[model samples]
Each structure stands twice: as structure tokens, then as C-alpha cells.
Target: MDVEILSRIQFAFTIAFHYIYPPLSIGLGVGLVIMEGMFLKTKEPVYEKMTRFFVKIFALIFGIGVATGIVMEFEFGTNWAVYSRYVGDVFGSALAAEGIFAFALESGFLGILLFGWNKVSPKVHFLSTIMVTLGSMFSAIWIVVANSWQQTPAGYKIVGEGMEARAEITDFWAMVFNPSSVERIMHVWIGAFLAGAFLIMSIAAWYLYKNKYQDFSKKAFGIGLVIALIAAYAQLVTGHSSAEVVEQYQPAKLAAMEGHWDSSGAADMYLFGYIDKKKEETVGLKIPGGLSFLTHQDFNAPVTGLKAFKPEDRPGSLNITFQSYHIMIAIGMLLISLTSYAAWLWRRNKLFEKKWLMLVFVWAVFLPQIANQAGWFAAETGRQPWVVYNLLRTSDALSQSVQKEQVMFSLILFSLVYLVLFMLFIYLLNKKITHGPWHTDSDKHSSRHSDMATELSKPSSQS
Candidate 1:
């Protein structure tokens, strides 16, 4: 492979791994605010204990997210110098705003949120929690805005010649609110919320299954379920909205996503399929004209297909884009079903009674994470060939001086380092889960004693 391929793979690997945490951090940040707010409103000790326990977990996620995230910025300059220079002026403004509006507020309040428990008044601590949540969300806004601007260039003009060429912001706010930004931002925010909510529910489900901290787990699961329910439905709506935006601005990507090749007819929405690129045919289940109705509210509306673009201009690999997109959609539908069923059970006061359901919740923790990653894979891969829509071809954006060997070596090192980090994360997370929320020795002792009694009452054959 050449430097461009190696660099792309290296960046993709780092970004994908790094992505795991931010959504969790963003999602968990929202959970923290709600948990803390409940404590404030009800003056309940259990709520405070829950808030404190999760705050520790949130800190762990935030620390790793920040650490892993710094590498991407350096990659931009080292691996894709041309790309960096091209978008630097635009990215600079957005990132600067993130530093000022998002990072500053989140970090300043973070200390209070983590360690200000008894030292600060309850109201003050609650305010800090809210600020931290807002900060994380605000952080997402600028990042998505910058990325979306690449998908749909706006309020910018090319201002140099040859290798010195770059885009300069002609209108700052217009650049910030680029055509695709608002929709993408909302889509990203909801995905993060779902990630965080599911993590909480997964942990809570495990606790409930083990018959540990019943009251606390119940409360936590209830809150997580509520958020998951709302976010799941909201994602469906935003997913549609985002798709519409893609249809209008990046139809080739949309075509690649659905594996549609012909421009003479309406597009079919595949439930699942395999694309045979050699034959240029997709075989599997599909709804006739489903995409057309979704995009144009008419079953026979013509949606642009891959045939509309030159072969070189289309997404480089359509199968990857198609599969990634379908995976995301499948997970989204699954989540909606899961949340709706869980809600029904909760309403019937039978949620905790179902071992099967709680078990599903425990494993379902990974679904949102998968969905988030898949969504990004689809978006980025679908935009292939063009790192900045019509403005900059990805091939033209590489750092000419970089070598394949250097990228390969760095990729190996990054893999090893990230493996260690991942192991550490799992170890810490497991340690915390196993420890449970034992505020006092008595609480721990009583919970253990209760577990022993419950076990003793079970059938000996099972034991």
C-alpha cells in the first residue's frame, strides 16, 4: 500500500477506537445531570449515591476520551498536511469556539462535579452537573459542524494556488451552520445520548440480575430506559432528516448507501443485501421505491443513482458503505423495539421480573456503540474520493512527504498502545461494577448477606 492508503487506515483505526469514549462521555454526561437532578428534587440518599458512583465512571471515560482524541489533531498535520491546510482556517474557528465555549465550561465545572460533593452545597453541585453536560454537548456541536462543512462546503472560498491553496471562511456563522451541520449535529447528539443511556442500563441490568442493590439499580434502570426510549424514537426522526439532507447535497453517497446503480428509475430501499460490484447488481430483500417515498414523499420519484456520477467520482467501495449503513439502520430499529418493549414492561411493573429481558439489556450495551461506529463508517466511507465534497479530492489531500513505512510503524504502535488502554478501561469498569455502590461497610455486608440468603433459597441443582 502507498502512504495515502496507510495513512487513511491508521487514521480510521485511531478515530474509530477513540470514538468509543466520546459518545459514552457525552451520553453519560446527560445521565449524570439527570441523576444529580433527581437527588436534588427528591432529597434521596440513593440518588446521591447513584450520582456519585456514575460520576467516578464518567471521569474515567472523560479522561480516556481526551487522551485518545489528541492524536487525531496531530495525524491531520502529519499524514494529511494538504487536507489540514485546506480546512485549517475553517477548523480553527470552530475548534477555538470549542475550547472557549465547550471545553472551558466542561473542564472548569468538572472538578466541582467530581470532587465537590460535601464541600459544595447540593444546589451548587447540581448546577455544576448541568454545566458539564452542556459543555460535552457543546463540544459535539463544533466538531460536527466542522465535519458537516466538509460534506457540504458553504461560506468559504478557495484562496491560494497549487499546494498553497486553502479555503478561507467568507462568513463565520454561515460556515458554522453549513447546510448539513444542524441535522448532523442533532443526529450525533442523540446517538451519544443513546450510547450513555444504554451503558447505564447495561450496568443496572447486571446489578438487578445479581440481586444486588435492588432499589438503586431499579432507579438507575428506570432513568436509563426513559432516555433510551426517547432517544431511540428521536434517532428515527433525525435519521430520516439526515437522509433527506444527504439526498439533496450528497446524492452519490446516498446512492452508494442503498447500492442503487441506475438513475433511470426510483430507488429501492434494501432491508438487507449483497452488492456484486463486478456485475453491478445488488441481490437481496428490498422495498420497491421505498427510498423514493422516503426522500420525495412519492413512490415513483426519481432519486439520483451512482450512474449519475463518473465511475471515479462515486464512492470508492460501495459494499462497505451499503453494509455499514444497513447495520446502523438495523440497530436503530432494534433499539426502538427494545426500548418500547422495556417501557411496556416497566409500565406493567414487570420489567425487573424478566431475567431474559435484563440479560438482553446487559448485552444491549454494545448495540448503541456499534450503531454509532457504523453510522460514522457509513458517512465517512460514503464520502470517499472527496474529503471535502466537490472542493478537495482525498487523493490530493495527502502529505506528499509521508511514507508508507512510517504510517505502518505508527499504526502498529498505536494498536499496541490502544490495546493496553482498552484493557485498562475494561479492568477498571469491571472493578467498579463488581464493587457495586457500597457507601458504607454495613451496606456492603448487608448486600452480601442478602445475596447469600437468596442463593441458599435457590434449588441445589442450580447451585
Candidate 2:
């Protein structure tokens, strides 16, 4: 009912929607690099075809991400003017750098990547792919530095006072390497890679299931599966390291994540089930003394609880954080299992024979998207009340002049528009996929990807 609430909802919905595409873009960028790199190294025509197919998908995703992301910038001036003004000095620089150091370079090479495949040399094309991948990562780095600074404010001093106060960066490098930046960015980038890898594997699995593009499917699927397994393991390690950092910097968030409410001694960590927020207790499965062992490797270590903080200082939505954290964990574990099993099947050279796993892989494309969303939900919701952690409460972050009706109207309008956009994306994607990766052998046509090849020898189609 409140204007601030409406504004928050609007920003959250639009940003979340915009977020969906970027990870796919980032992930797909990694996929593109691998595909094109192999094309250069091995002179495989299949790899070239795969690179072209992914280029189309990547371009589409990049277009949508750029379009949707512009809306968030407008919202900063409209819905969060006060918050923007407060941290403008610190945050604006990061965004500015993102544009200059990241977006410009990526966009400049994107033309070469998408269209220059036919016009340029293969080695040159491969170089473009690498640039795009690095650009995506650089974009993520600056944004992560900004957001991580909010979670763990450092390298800044408060200027002025009260309503007129603003944070000014005192040490630039210190701000860049703030306590949570590296860990948070590592987790985010890996998640993006997972999103991309699973998507490729999912599409490849579908082709195999339909008995279409067998050789193409096998190669693409194998590459994606290998990357998925490695990224899955990397995610586990980064998630653990991030948690350790959170233990030191954002203990209240860790408290909410594990659903631990005791003020002292060994704390139980809930693995699943419901949190009784009213009672500050968990109502499901938990590992006894898990919290203590997890954080300190000691069963008797004291973990801070919500009760330790004044009621007003506690995160507003403990239940959301608790549920989101567990949901993320559940999906992450499932992904590890699925990728591991796929690796086993491939090792035996019987992966396609398992129709059950083929079906699972086809549907598994949605898993990384879900897991990525859940992880973010846990992180953002758990850091609530304070938009800038301990320094700035979210209540103080809203635009003073914004009205509830204005935000609500925009929210409704944006939601409807986004829904249509989503339907269109799926429709076009299905159309492209249903047409198959490229022409079959019966067509007697030179492959569409032939232009992308610069090798001394032509690749013979296998199977």
C-alpha cells in the first residue's frame, strides 16, 4: 500500500527480469569462446556450426539484456533518487566504469562476432569471442564491486550529516577490493557460467532425444557437460568461501540463512523445512551443531542470532531468507548430482541410450535459472532493512517525492510488457531450434557455417 513498497516491488520485478538475460549472456559468452576456440584449434566444422548457432542465441540475449537494463537506470532517478544521491559518488563511478571498460568493448566486438564470421578470418573471429567473454566478466566485476560495497561498506567516509550526508570514496582500490567483492563476484560469475553450460546441454539433449543432429548434439553436449561439472564444483567452493566471509562480515545474514536463533553456544543448521518466524525457531530437518562446525570447525562455537541484535536492527524478512537459502542449496546439490551422473554415462559412451537422462537434461535447462534466482533471493533478502548494510536503512533510501500510485501503475505496465516479451523470446527460440542446428545430409547444400571456416581442409560429416 505504501509508495516505497510499490517502488521496491517495481524495481525488484524489472531488475529480476533483466537479470535473467545477463547471466545467460555471460554464460553463453563462455560457451561461444569455447566453441569458436575449438573451431580455430581443431578446424572442426561441427564446432564452427555450433559457434554460429550460439552466436545467434547470444546476440538475441545481449539485445534483450541491454534493452531491459536501461529501464533500471531510469528507475534510479525516479524510484530511488534519494538512495542514488546518497551513494552517487561511490556507485556512479562503478557504473561509469562498467560502461567504458565493459559495455563499450563488448559492443564493439559484438558486430565482429555476430556478422564478421563470413567476412573475416577464423583467427580474428576467435579473438572477438575472447574479447566478448572478457567484457562480460569485466561488466560483472564493477557491478559486483558496487553491490558488495553496499553489503560491506569500506574505503569511504561520510560527508555532510543526516539527510544531507553522502559517502565519498577515500581509497579507490580499497573500495574495489572490499571484504565481500571477490567472493561475491566469483560466486556470481560461476553461476552465470552454469546457466550458460546447462542451456547448451539442454538444447543438445533435446536434439539427441529427437534423433536429430546426432554428431552435433554429441559434441555440444559433451562440451557443456564437462564445463557444467567443473563449474558445479567451483560453485561449491566459492559458495563455501562466500559463507565464511559472510560469517565474518554479515553474521546476521548468516544467522538468517542457517535459521539459527540461539544467542550463544552450538547452533543447529536447518537443511530443510519451515522456519517459525513468530517463535524464532525452525520446524523441520536440521543437523545438530552443524552451524558451529560449519563456521568455526568447533561444535561449541557461538553463532550470533537475531536476538543478539536490537529488534529494529534485524533483517525484516527472516522467513524469506531462510527459505531461499535452503531452496538454493537443494537445487545446487541436485545440479551436482545430475552433472556427475551425466559424466558417468558419457564415460561409458552410453549417454544417449539413457532416455530418462535425456529427458532430465532437456528439462534441466531451467535448473540453473532457478538456482541462480534462489541464491540471489537468499543474499538480497537476507541483507534487508539496511540497504547499505549497517550504515543506511532501506526506509531512508526511497525517493521523497515518488507516489504509491505512480509506482504501482508502472509496475503493472512493466509486468504486462515483460510477459509479452517473454512469450515472444520463447516463441522465436523454439522456432530457431525446431528448424534444427543446420541442414541435414539429405539437403545436398553446403553447410551454412562453411563461411566461418578458414582451415586448409574441409571436415567430412560423420554419422
Candidate 3:
């Protein structure tokens, strides 16, 4: 109804859709390195085939991630012109660093990694894979640094310009390692890794269930399960640390997430409940003293509540924040359990033969994606009224000149385009998986090429 509300909706929709691809790209990049590295080590044709098959998939995702991401960058300037101008100096430097250190390096090596199978030596090709993977991670680093600067307002000074104030970068290193950067980056990368690992396991589990490519599926599942388990466990630690940072720096947001209304010592953690903000109490189960221990590592420590601050200063929809956080945590725990069970089965040499379990794994591939989206919702929605924490209100950040109808039209267009792109991606990926690699006869051709070239150059074998 309102222009500001419409603008917020448009941005959120675009960002959420765009987010789906990048984590897959980053996670798949790491998986590609692992697959290719194993091929080099074992000199196995199956491993090489696996690498080639998935690299094609990775290339498609990388392209989509880049394509979708470009639109959001443009929106920053077009829809949120004032916000862009205010944070431009800080954002510009970080973005420039991303282009120079990440995008360029990754793009340069990508062609070689994709097309140099027979043209380059194995060692050289492996080097290219490493570069691409690191480049993806480097890209994430700079982007997170820029976002974290907004969250914590570090490495910058506000300069008064006319009536409004603009931020200027004052300490470059401080900006890179802002208060929230380390925890956020760690949480994000681990989520990416989990997304990639689960994807591989899902496909492999399907193949195993159908009794196709049994050996390949077995190896793929084993490797994927191990990586998934480790990443999920590491995420729990990082998530806790990130929550601690939020408690200290963004108490209102944290208070909203836990549905805390009255400040108290030895707070209770609501395990499953609906909080009636009007009544100021939870409607279901809660674990007393859990919140205090979680936040401060002590049972009787004091934790802030929403009542501590003015009502208007609070972030959006406490119910949404609480539900999203709990759902994400539940999914994370489920991932750990599933992978752990898979690992135990692997140790007993029974994982590949479990038909029901394999089927579950096939469908359960979507769980990590759901968890990833929910986690993002909890973080962004939890931040509420402030676009840059207490420094800038979201209402003041929107472009004054843009019409509501314009935002609505663009939102409709974006949704249709993204839906088509998603369908195409799924179709192409399924085609690649079904058809297998281009060179299934890789072993036969391995020595044939070298021998044929050598003989052809040796005076026509005059004997």
C-alpha cells in the first residue's frame, strides 16, 4: 500500500532469490576442488569423470549467481539512492577490492578449469581449480566486510554534508575486521559448505537407490557425508559466537529473537512457544536458565529485554524472528544427526545398500536450503527499523523520487524471470546427471592421444 513498504518488499524479494545461488556456487566450488584433487591423487578415471560432470554444473551456477547479483547492485543506486550515497565511500572500496582480488582472478582461471582438460597438464589444471575456489571465498569475504561495517559502523567517520551525514572510510583494516565480520563470515561459509555437501549426497544417494553407478555413488556419499557433518558441527559453534556478539552489540534484536519482554537474571530459553507481546509471556515450553548460560556462560547472568528500550526502536515482527531462529536451529541439529547416522552406516559398510535411508537422503537435500533461507531471514528481519543499526533508519534510506508503481512493476518482472531461470537450471542439471560425462571412455583415450601423437611424428614408422 505504502511506497516505502513496497520498496522494502521489492528489495527483500530480490535479495532472497539472489541469495539462493551464491551459497551453492561457493559450496560447489569447494566440492569441485575436493573432487578434482582426489582425481589427481588417485589417478582414477571415475574420479576424473565425477569432476568433469560436476564442473559443468558448477559453471552454470556460477553464471547464474553473477547474473542475479548484478541486478541487486544496480538496485542499491536506483531504489536506495540516499543510502547508497551515504555508505558509498565505504562500500566502494570493499567492492573494488572484491573485483580486483576475487572476480577477476576467478574468471581468469575459470576458462582454463572448464576447457583445459586435455590441453593442459593435470598439475596445471588442479592449480586452476584451487584458484577458482579461493577466489569464490575471497569474493564472499569482501562482501561480508562491507555488510558487517554497516552493522557495527567501524572504520568510518560521519562527515556532515548539508543536513544529512555521510560515512567516509577512516581505517581500512578496521573495516575489514569489524565486530561482526568474523562471526558472520564463518557462519556464512559453513552454510555454503553444507549446501554444497548435501547437494552431492542427495544426487549420489538417488543413484545408489536406483542401483546406477553404484561405486561412484558410494564414494560420493561417503565424502559428502563427512564434509556435511563437519561443517554442520562447526556452524553450531560459529552460530553461538555470533549470537553472543548480537547480545552485546544489538541487544534489542537479540531480545526480540528470544521473545524477552522483561529484563531478568537467569533468563529462560523458549524451546517451543508463541509469545503474546501484549501479555508479555510465552505460551509453551521453555528451559529456565538456558538463555543466561547461552549468552554469558553463566546461569544467573543478566540479559537485556525489549522493555529496556522504547517500543518504536524495536525491530520487525518478533514472532517471525523467534520462529525463524528456532526452525533454523532445529534443521541444523537434524542435519548433524542425519550425517552422523550416515557416517556410522559407512563405517559398517552398509550405507550404500540402505534403500529407505538412501531415499530419505534424496528428498532431504532440500532441508539445508530451507535452513539457509530461514537463517538469513532471522538475521535480516531481526535487524528491523535500522538499515545500518542505530545509525540509519530504513525509512530514511529509500529513494524519494521513485514511484510505488515502478517498484511493484519491477518486482513482478523479477519474479517471472527468476522462476524461468530456476526451471531451466533444474532441467539442465538433471540432463547432465542422466547423460553422465562427455568422456566415459577416458581411460582408453588417456594413453591413445600421447601414443598416437608420438607415432605420427616418428617418420611414419618406417619399419
* lDDT at position 109, candidate 2: 94
Alpha-carbon lDDT of model 2: 0.86
How far does residue 250 in candidate 3 sit from its true spot (Å)?
0.7
Q: All candidates' TM-scores?
A: 0.95, 0.96, 0.94
Higher-lDDT candidate of 1 and 3:
1
lDDT of 2 by residue, 1-463 (tens): 7987788779878988988988998998998888878877777677888888878888888888888989998998898877888899989889999999999999999899877855677788889999998898899999989999999999999998888888999999888999999999999999999999998999999999988999999999988998899999899999999999998999899988888888777988888877776887878898888889988898788899877887777777888888888888888899999999889988998888998888899999988888888888888888888889888888898888888888888999999999998888888788878877684331332433464343335444331
Q: Count of backbone clashes for each model? A: 0, 0, 0
Better of 1 and 2 by lDDT: 1
Error of 1 at 25 (Å): 1.1
Where is the poorest 10-residue window by lDDT in model 2?
440-449
Deviation in angstroms for 286 in model 3?
A: 1.4
lDDT of 1 by residue, 107-142 (tens): 999999887765677788889999999999999999
Give each prediction's root-mean-square deviation over alpha carbons. 6.1, 2.4, 4.3
Alpha carbon lDDT of each predicted model: 0.91, 0.86, 0.83
Between 1 and 3, whose TM-score is larger? 1
Give the CA lDDT, 0 to 100, for residue 430 in model 2. Answer: 84
Residue 382, model 2, lDDT: 84
